[model samples]
Target: MTSEPITVVLGSASPARLRVLRDAGLDPLVLVSDVDEEAIVDRLADAAPEHVVTALAQAKADAVVETIRGGDDPLFDAARTDGVVLTCDSMLLLDGRLSGKPHSPEVAIEQWHRMRGSTGHLITGHCVTRLHRGEADAATGHQSTSVRFSDVSDTLIERYVATGEPLKVAGAFTLDGLGGWLLDGIDGDPSSVIGISLPLTRRLLTDLDVDIADLWRA
Candidate 1:
């Protein structure tokens, strides 16, 4: 007899994150968290960048956990058995300041202008929640990657911003997308720069006694 596959719930709306997991072989049911990010940041305004991202990722995971256990949404109870929830939050720490999605052309343009010829650490916080037999537990961690940007001309930055890609991602750049050409190089996990660190996620899952391989789609 064959055993049932474990359900994997993703608690963020980031397409990049989703793509990362899917491309890695785990099929997850996306359950975007509705948590107020600004509120979370405001509450942890004095915290360090790592602490901020960790708290944000945990908050998002907790919110999704509530949604899954609070009701009878058929989709939420995908497996009706053991499962796991994954959540992540990313930010760019540059020149002693941390920033998430610029969200505006002007802001993105400004971010790129400052980022050109500079290096920043991309910190991605991760949380993995295990749900087994009506009980839930979580483990969390983070990864940081040093990203160096090319000293491109103003015209290039302006043109990139016009594409509107940078406005929707953290650090105003992507390692695997249109912004790839703007970078000189990186000194850490490339996946973390994209959004989630596979190595870190594996460790977090192991901490929860969940084997990543067991969660992979057949």
Candidate 2:
């Protein structure tokens, strides 16, 4: 590891992912990628949820990496020297169907109706692009968590949907937000369910020969 700390370039606009990293002691520079998620998902219509999420995450990372390589933005100068671009995409797989952000109140309500009292697999793909010593390398992986929803009533679902939280998040629920009240339990990493998997991220950083500790805030 370099004596200098590695900067974290978060290639996502998700507040949840940024919070996850910040709470874990790493301060990340947020860079939102303009990748068309719906287009990518449509292109991989028949692929497994794991593969789809991974492809989406890689696409986002690649987009941001291109911007960093352009060298036009002084914001990325530190990142170009010794930084890791981390991107993630998450979806909920239920009954062989994949669902990303509902993006609509009606869709959120429908998703909750189908998910209430049922279990869904929350899969989050992670991609890490390391820019160190003028060379860039990447590693990708995913984490899957089984989340069980409570037998919430329609009235409650309607109330939750009114809050508009479900419309902006995958699975129409969250373990660390207002939706937490509607979830019974989770069988995997809770951090992944929130947005990013700390353990999986650590392993990916290891693959790129960067220690997670080296990326921690001073």
Candidate 3:
């Protein structure tokens, strides 16, 4: 059978997520949502970290879907042609407190200091919206991984912060970057830390009747 062309709309500006899609052989169109992340997290003050991430991911996907339906953007046309929209949010939880991207170098340094000699969980949530017959079907889910960090020295944290990678990453570190040096081990999917969990995403797409391999062929 011939493969169907499935256009993918990525509701994030993260390079790591884009790389994941590309490495999986899917060409995803990037759409950075303008939703206020802090407000969303604040509103979910009573929820678990996994729930909060899932909610934020769904919110971002819904915002993008609304924009596509209400505007003349080309992505809307893509959606009309059996495209899929994907959104994701990630956070680090240490002792039940959520840790998102650090706002400044000092914040990154402080977070690293707190994370030192501690084992934490990284949770990433994904939302998928499949547009069909002018309607959208959406699913939301989360993936978590346990990360253990060795005792990090002040000099090392300072040097890593100077690289500027920690500022934009959850937990103030990127497992694929110099931050890997700090990790003693991980207990789940590492890709979840990068923002998108491949296994979780694959299952969601399967439920929508979209074969990920078909997208790779496209």
Candidate 4:
């Protein structure tokens, strides 16, 4: 027996996510989703951090599918009619508020001041969608991990933020880059804090009736 070919579409521009997929042995096609993240965040201001990220992940998946369907791309060629789309969103939960991409040096510094020597939840939402013959199937869920920040001096915080690495990353910190030294240790999936969780993504794909091993084979 032979299986049909499948193409996995990553609906995000985050290099962290791309690296995760590559490490998992899947070469996914990148398609940056054009969704208004701030609009959704504002609309769900009262919702839990997990729920908000989940909604954003779903929105990204929807946007990617809509874009591909509107075009006659070979990704949807008759032979590979059923293609998989994966999208994710992450946020930091600090003092009971959802935060994503500080967007400014001041905001990043402010966030770090409050985060120093504190524990926060790094929540990553995952969505996997399968498109076949005009029909779509999807599964969405979230993964949360506890991140503890190092109690660094104010001078160090300023130095780190000045590097401009924290301004565009969720939580204003990362475990795999310049921010690695700023973390004490994470209590859960380290990949979740970076951007996407491999375990979570595997489960989501299973929920959509897709085999995780197939992705690794690519």
Candidate 5:
């Protein structure tokens, strides 16, 4: 590992992901991707959710890596920096179907109704692009968490939908927000369900020869 502490640019705008990184001792700079998520979903209509999610994550990472390579950020100084550009995508797999941002309040309500008392998978794909002197070398890994939901009432689901949280998250819910009460348990890293996985991220950083401790700058 280099004596210099490494910095990271998160290739997403997810507040949850940002919090996860900060809580794990690495502070990341946010750079939202312009990748058309809906278009990617449509293009991979027949693909498995796992593959589709990873593809989207890689696409986002690639986009941001290209953006930085074209010009250095005064803060990041990509041209001389050794850093990581992280991107991730999460989706809930319920009964073999992929679920992401129910979009409409009605859809959120309907999905939550079915999700109650159910067990499903939350898959999050992670991509780490190593920026060495502005050149890119990428590594990727993904995690799947099994989540069990509480058997809540229809009124509760409707009320939660009205809160408008479900409408903006994958699987019409979240583990860190109001949706927490609705979750009975999780079988894997809760952070992955939130947006990113800390343990998995460390492995990816190691794969790219970046020391995870170097990011903490202690």
Candidate 6:
């Protein structure tokens, strides 16, 4: 573990990502990047699911970096110097189409119907940035996991949608919540399904010269 404490900034407002970092014993500052995620995704409409998620993650991190740089707050400046920024985006790939967060309960129901009794790929893209010797050292990567869902009934889908958990999550389901009941199994990192992949995040941080052991020490 390093003697110096590193300020880890999470460039997202996701509670799940925040919890992941906290569980890993790192105190991360949350900064929600105000990027037009849907617009960015639209621009890459022809891209693969993995590429789309990766691009969105990078866009989010870049937006946060720019936002911080444009501000004159001394605290923000200090944070930029002493902290690492982490950003991530997730998407679901079913067949050849990308499934995103549902815009409404109706959409959630439809997506759930499509996902019923099917297996899909959950892809999460992560970006980590830190200031090093007058330049920013940024690294971007992604993790893909296969998830199989049990057969779901319309009654269950409607009930889940009414709970409002599906509206804000990619693929219209939360792997750690009531939605887990719909999943049969996962072939990769379960944390990725929740929103962020901790193992992948750790690797990116390590590549950026942040010590994972130090960050994980309670």
**Residues 1-218 of candidate 5: C-alpha lDDT, one tens digit per residue:** 57666778999988888998888887787788889998998999899888888999999998888777666578767423777899999899998888888989998988887889999999998899998865789998889999999999999999999998888888888999999999999999988999998889899989998878888836
| Model 2 spans with C-alpha error above 4 angstroms | none
The global C-alpha lDDT for each of the candidates, from Candidate 1 onward, is 0.91, 0.93, 0.87, 0.88, 0.87, 0.84
The per-prediction CA RMSD against the true structure, in angstroms, equals 1.5, 0.9, 1.4, 1.6, 1.4, 1.6
Error of 5 at 120 (Å): 0.6
CA lDDT of 111 in candidate 3?
89
Worst 10 residues of 6 by lDDT: 73-82
User: Candidate 2 residues 45-111, lDDT tens each?
Assistant: 9998899999999999999998888757887889988899999999999999999999999999999
Residue-wise C-alpha lDDT for candidate 6, range 74-105, written one tens digit per residue: 66765656667889999999989898889799
TM-score, every prediction: 0.97, 0.98, 0.95, 0.95, 0.95, 0.94
Flag regions of model 3 displaced more than 4 Å.
1-3
Determine which window of 10 residues in candidate 2 has minimal summed lDDT: 1-10
Which residue segments of model 4 deviate by more than 4 Å?
Answer: 75-80
Q: Report, for all candidates in order, the number of backbone clashes.
A: 0, 0, 0, 0, 0, 0
- Model 1 poorest 10 in a row by lDDT: 73-82
Mark the regions of model 5 whose C-alpha exceeds 4 Å error after superposition. Answer: 78-80
Worst 10 residues of 4 by lDDT: 73-82
RMSD of 2: 0.9
Instruction: Give a tens-digit lDDT track for model 1, residues 1-218.
Output: 22667899989888999999999999999888888998999999999999999999999999899888886889877533578999999999999999999999999989888999999999999999998888999999999999999999999999999999998899999999989999999999988999999999999988988778888778
Candidate 6 Cα errors over 4 Å, as ranges = 1-3, 74-77
Q: Of the candidates shown, which would achieve the greatest TM-score relative to the real structure?
A: 2
| lDDT by residue (tens digit), candidate 4, 160-207 | 999989988998998899999999999999888889898988888778
